[model samples]
Target: MNDLQQQLAAIVGPAHVLTGEAELASYLTDWRGRYRGRALALVKPGSTDEVAAVVRACAAAGVPMVPQGGNTSLCGAATPDQGGRSVLVNLSRLNRIRQIDAANNAITVEAGCLLAQVQEAAAAAGRLFPLALASEGSCQIGGNLSTNAGGVQVLRYGNTRELTLGLEVVLPDGCLWNGLTALRKDNTGYDLKDLFIGAEGTLGIITAAVLKLFPRPRAVVTAWLAVADGAAAIALLGRAQARFDARLTAFELISRQSLDLVLQHIPGSRQPLAAPAPWQVLLELADGGAWADLQADLEDFIGGEMADGRVQDGVLAQNETQARQLWALRENISEAQKIEGLSIKHDISVPVSRIPEFLDLAGTALAAAFPGVRVVAFGHAGDGNLHYNLSKAQRQDNDAFIAATPQANRIVHDLVARLGGSISAEHGIGQLKREELVRYKDPVGLDLMRCIKSSLDPRGLMNPGKIL
Candidate 1:
């Protein structure tokens, strides 16, 4: 082994340090299969102290360090670069629950714990960890915090940023900062946790975190509704929010084209409604009470809307099994799209009220630009974020369509900007959206971001070639 590899092996046993090409293939590539990189070594540290030692060793060698968890980054944030000079630090071995204060309604966990593991731990204590994602089965807390994940429950519980109470991070210079406080009212100073929460590992590596928890809801209900278009969907969302308030936990929008893909690709997945509509909404409400009472009220609400022509048709799930079936449809859209063929995805957001106009304008422009471009639009409409995707089915034409990502992004993102929205909502600006971030980010804000990055990591050895 070389000098640096020997040092890394010594810090975290040689068995934990992998340098073989076969052992490193999966870690080098991204979940989307869009980015692949090489690393000097992949080390899995078992504790905070070991991680500090590894970071110090890499820092002394003047080599870049990429901190990874779960390797489930959709935007290439977890993958290292092609330079082959950096060490990939995997925190999977640090998985552990440090503490869970039921009275404080908070849980402290090591960064590498799977999101599902944290959720189960919270449930065992009769509480709820409101961040729910499709990849919860495999995604880790560190990666979730790094990307500032916004999932289906974001409308009710907020994103990972709000759910976080404190963080323990290892600075680029090998110093460990312990801000792992579970207090909800610590107004001591600027919340340092916020800086590393959404920074995508650019400033430092997140080692552990204190996450907020809520009382488990005693009653829950789920429903699927068909609407005329985006305008109708937004109108329904406003009325639902006004009526249910905080009890409304989820509101997902799905297009007909998107559903068709799911129905065709996913086996045993029958259509939810009798007749298909242009658009659909998956709504869920959860709180304390008898579920039958909530379900009855929701059925009445949907009945009244359908009677008034606001809702075309609707069905309320009568049982938990049925509710999960309904949720499966909404959560499986991305997987279904991936199974079909090549496509480009845009996770953008605008004012909830402007969703309809943005959709119409962007759809019209893309249709004009590419005649057969299939636009699959769906997302958490309640939060004004949508996963807008474009694709063409013809195998011969898929390559050309994929190559036109820049043009398609221009048409869609320019419209998002014109409507006073963001180009990236929950997904961070990894290599994929690095240029897009620079194009749309404000001059003053961009400069401030650069200043913060320089102040934290002037050497640019922490996850280089990202964001800035």
Candidate 2:
């Protein structure tokens, strides 16, 4: 074994150091199964101290370290690059909820804890850890923090970065930064935790965190609304927010093609509206009181929207089961798309007011560029984020379509930029979006990011070939 490999094995026992092809295979491929890489070894560290030691050993030997958590990154953020010189630091063994303070409404947890486990811990204490996602069961909190994940509840609770109170990170040099303070108000210096929150494991390795919690919602109402177009969905959102305000937990927009894919792929999927409109919005509202009256609120708002012809048809959930059924249609989009086959995907975001314009312009531009291409656009519309994807025609095979990704991205991302939107809204700029990020980011922004990365990781050993 090489010097660095020996050191890694010593740091986290030889048994935890996986060099076999089969064991390392899963760590190399991303969630989308798009990019696959090779690594010298996969090192599993079971604690913050162990992580620091492993990182320090790698730094000493000048080996690049790829920090992996849950391996659920859509953008290959948690996957190692093909270079084979680096070692993958798997953090799944560190999963643990260290503490849950009901009084402070906070939870201290290791970075490898699954997001769903954190939610359950909060629920046990009669609080809600609202940073949720479709992959919560497998995605770790560290991955969520790294990507600054935006899920359905982000409209109400905010992204993982906002929900975070503090973090424990292993610096590039192998020194541990104990920033895991549970204090709600820490007016201390640069708020260093914010730097690592969305760094995509490039700046440092996040080992643990202190996450904020909220009072559990006593009532929730989920509704599926059929809208004529993206503009109508935006208008409906505005009208509902005027009445519900903070109670509005989520507002998702699903395109007809996207919904059809769900029905075609997922079992037990049924249409919510009889006459399918061009677009659908999944609206959700939750409150902490028993007298939340979400039904009355939705009925009144839907009544006005229907009268104004903004909404054509709708189905409000009568119970929790019905609510989940509605959500299943929204949550299973990625899975359904996977079943459909390979496609070019974008997680773009614009200002809430300009989403309608973005959708119209991007759709028009893409159609003009690639005729007969199926556009599957859907996602958290309330946050101005959309999972805009384009699938090849049924007759065309995957390879022919895959070759058109660059052209398709140009048509879609250029419009997103023109509309003052982010090329990468929720997904981090992993290996997949590194080139796109360079193209779209302004000079000053890129320079600042470079400065931050150079300052923290002077050796350029942390998660190399990712982000900057």
The candidate maximizing lDDT is 1
Task: Return the clash pairs for model 1, or none.
Answer: none
What is the C-alpha lDDT profile of model 2 across 1-468, one tens digit per residue?
388878888888999999989988888999888999999999999988999999888888888999999998888887787778889999999899999999998999998999999999999999999987888889998898998998988887898888999899999998999998998887967899989988999999999999999999898888899988998889888888888899999999999999999999999999998887799999998897663476777788888778887789999988999989999999999999988888898999999999889888888887787777788999999999999998776746556767989998998888888888899889988988989998999989999999999999988999998998
Model 1 misplaced regions, further than 4 Å: none
Residue range 246-300, candidate 1, lDDT tens digits: 9999999999999999998998787999999999999999989999899988998
lDDT score at residue 144, model 2, on the 0-100 scale:
89
Which 10-residue window of candidate 1 scores lowest in summed lDDT?
391-400
Best model per TM-score: 1
Candidate 1 Cα RMSD after full superposition onto the native fold (Å): 0.9
* TM-scores of all predicted structures: 0.99, 0.97
